[model samples]
Target: LVKPIELWTGKQLFSVLLRPHANMRVYVNLTVREKNYSKSGETMCPNDGFVYFRNSELICGQLGKATLGNGNKDGLYSILLRDYNAYAAAACMNKLAKLSARWIGNHGFSIGIDDVQPGGRLNENKRARILEGYGKCDELIQSYNKGMLKLQPGCDAAPTLEAHISSFLNNTRETPAKVCMEELHWRNSPLTMSQCGSKGSPIN
Candidate 1:
C-alpha cells in the first residue's frame, strides 16, 4: 500500500505541486524578496520568507507575480513546462484554479482607497521625486529647444530628448512605487494581494 504524506504548510503543498517526486527540483528566485533579504543581513527570515526556494520548498520568502504570473518565461508555470512538460503545467493550473475558488468561497476580499492611498513620508517622497524628475525634464526640453541636446545613437535631437525624459520619468515613478511598498504594512490588503499574485502586481 502507498503511504500518504501529509503537507503541514502551504509551502509544502506548493512544493508538492512543483516536485511531486523526491527526484524533482525547482529553483525559484523572487527578486523583490531577495533584494530586501540581502539588505541588513536578514536573509534568514526563519519563517520561510526567503527570496529563494531551496529544493522547491519555500524556506523564507513570499511568492509573488514574478514566480506565479504568466507574463514571464521564468514563472512557475513556465518552469513547470520547461522542466517537465505542458501537461504538468496544465495540471498544476487546474489544481490552483480549483483551490482558489474554494478559498474565495470562504474568504472576503476588497481593496479600499485607504489601502493604496499615499500618506505621510510616502507622499513626501513621491512629490519630491516628481519635482526632481520634472526639473530634469524641463532642463532637457530647454536644451532641445536651444539645439544643445545630446542626440542618442541613430536618433535626432527630439527623439533623444524624449528618450531621456521618458527614462527620467520612469525612474521617478519607480522611486515612489518602491517607497509606497516599503511604507505599507506587510499585512496591508493590497500589498498582500500583490505579493501573492492573486490580483494586480505591486506596481499597480
Candidate 2:
C-alpha cells in the first residue's frame, strides 16, 4: 500500500524484492570487467551492461549468476545473510522462486528454429576454422607416416601426433563458440540465458 504505482511488470515485482521495506537498503556492484566495462566504476557504461544497485534499487545491469549465483562470496544472498541474517536470505530466496515461476509461466520462453540457425558469415567462418583444424591434423599424420615427426619429451611419434591433433580440434570447437556469441543478437532468448549464466553456454 505504501508504494505509489500498481505493479504490472516482472521488474516491478523485482524492485519490491530488493526494497522490501522503506528503511532497508543495499548498494552493490557486480559488473564484469571486459571490453566496454571499466574496473574503476561502471556508472559511466553507455550500454547499462554494468550491475549497480543504489538505495536498494537496481539502477543498471542484468540480473545474472554474478548477482544470484552461489559461488560468489559477495553475491546478493550472501550480502543479505551478512548484513541481516540467514532468515532474511532464505525469505528472499523464497520470493525469487515464486516470482520466477509465476513470471515465466505468464510469459513462456522457447528456442525457435531462428534462434539456433547460423548466419552466412558465421557459417563461412566456422567452415574455415574446421578446415584449418583438419589441415593441421593432416600435416601431423603425414609427418608420422614419413617417420619425420618430432617426438615429445617422453612420448613416441604416434602419441605426439594424437596429442597435437586433439589440441587443434579442441580449438576448432572453442573458436566457433566465440564467433557464434558475437553473431547472435543480445535479445535472443538462448543467448540471453547463456550470457546470464543461467543455463547453456556459448558452445551449446
Candidate 3:
C-alpha cells in the first residue's frame, strides 16, 4: 500500500516520500510539458527528464534532460519523488516548500516528495530552517488577505453597513413571525429591504 504525505506552506503544497533500506536508489522523473491546453484539455508537448539522488551528507539531484518533438524547450515541469530515506527525504521536501514560497509564488505548481510525512523527524537545524521558512509564508498570506479586504466594497462601507444591519436585526429579533413575513413580502426583495442588504449581497 502506498501512503501519500503532504505538507502545506501558505503559498504551496509539498508531498514527501520515504522508503526502507532495500530500496535506497532514488530516481526523480521530472517531466516538462507545455502549459498550452488543447480543446480537449490535454497538453500539447510533454517531454521527460530525470534526476538521481541517494542518501549522503549532502543530498542533491543530478539533472538529466529530455528532447522535445519541435526541438524547443519545455516550459512547465513536474517532479516525481521515488525511493528515499527519512532524513534525506524530509530535507528534500523542506527545500521544495521554501523554493515554492520564495521563487514560484502563485504562478508555479506544487512539488511532491514521494513518501514522507509533515511531522517526520529531522536534524535540529533543518527543522528550524523549515519552521522559519513556513513562518515567512504565513506572513505573505496575511498580507494578501489584508490587501484583498481593502479592495472589498463591504469592508470600505463597513461602518454604515454595520449600523444598519445591527438595527434591522435587533428590531426583527422579537417581531412576530407573520408580521416579519408580511414585512419581507412588502419590501419586495431583500435587496430593497434595507440599505445594508444591497451592499451585503453574497458573491456566490
Candidate 4:
C-alpha cells in the first residue's frame, strides 16, 4: 500500500521488507528532486523548505489514517530539538516553568547555585537574576504554588501556562506525558539521565 501525499511535488520512494509467511515492515521515504518553479520559468526556492506539521499530534493524525500506530511518541520533540539552538532551548525552558534552581546556569547565563535546590530555594538574589534574563517577575513564579494566581475575576486558578501542564499531569496520574517522561523515575523506570531538555535533548 502507498502512503498518502501531503501536497509535495517531490518523488517519494517506498520499500517494504517481508519474511516468508511471517510479519512485514513498510517504510516510505520522501525526497525532494528539485525546487518547484513558478509560472515565470524560474526556479522558486521556497523559504519554508518543506511542508510539515508543527507538532507530534498533527503528524500522528496524518500517519494513523494510513497505518495504525506508525508514528513514534517523541518524534515531534526530536525534530524540534534538532533544529533548536542553545539560546532557543533555554528561552523555551524558562517560559515553560520557573526552573527549580537546579536547572540554572550553563546557558551562557551566570546564576548563583545557592538558590535552585531543596536546600537552596530561589531566594531574592537568584530570583532577581533569573527574572532579569527571562523577562518574568519572581512574583509570577511564586503565584504558581500559592493560591494567588488567578485567571478571571474571583476565580482562583493557576496561570494559563501552569494550568495547561497541570491538567495533563492530572490525566496521567501526576506523571509527565511527553517532555518530562525520561527525567522522572517511576516504579519501574530506572534513573537514566541527569536532566533532559524541553525539546527531548540531554542537558548536562
* Off by more than 4 A, model 2: 1-16, 25-60
lDDT of 3 by residue, 1-204 (tens): 124756432211222332224455544333332222112322221211121223321122111222112322331122222333455545655665576487556554332342111222223434554565566545544655565323334554345444544555443332333233323322233322221222222110
Candidates in order have lDDT scores of: 0.69, 0.74, 0.33, 0.30
Per-residue lDDT of 1-204 in model 2, one digit per residue for the tens? Answer: 236966543445556886677776543334332222335557666544466666456655556777777367767788778877887778778989998888789987778999999999889989999889888888889999999999989999878888888888988998888889888997689987877778788789
| Model 2 residue 90 distance off true place after TM-score fit, in angstroms | 2.9
Model 1 lDDT at residue 3: 44
Error (Å) of candidate 1 at residue 97 is 6.2
Instruction: Give one digit per residue, the lDDT tens place, for model 1 in 1-204.
Output: 124765454656676666678765445333234222334434556423344556566555556655667467756677668877887788878877777688767874666888878889987888888889888988999999999998889999878987998898888888878778778976688877765656765568
Q: Write the number of the candidate with greater TM-score, choosing between 2 and 3.
A: 2
For model 3, the stretches where C-alpha displacement exceeds 4 angstroms are 1-26, 30-82, 104-204
| TM-score of each prediction | 0.60, 0.73, 0.18, 0.17
Pick the TM-score winner.
2
Q: Count clashes in each candidate, considering only residues at least 3 apart in sequence or on different chains.
A: 7, 0, 9, 1
**Candidate 4: 10-residue stretch with minimal lDDT:** 11-20
Backbone clashes in candidate 2 total: 0
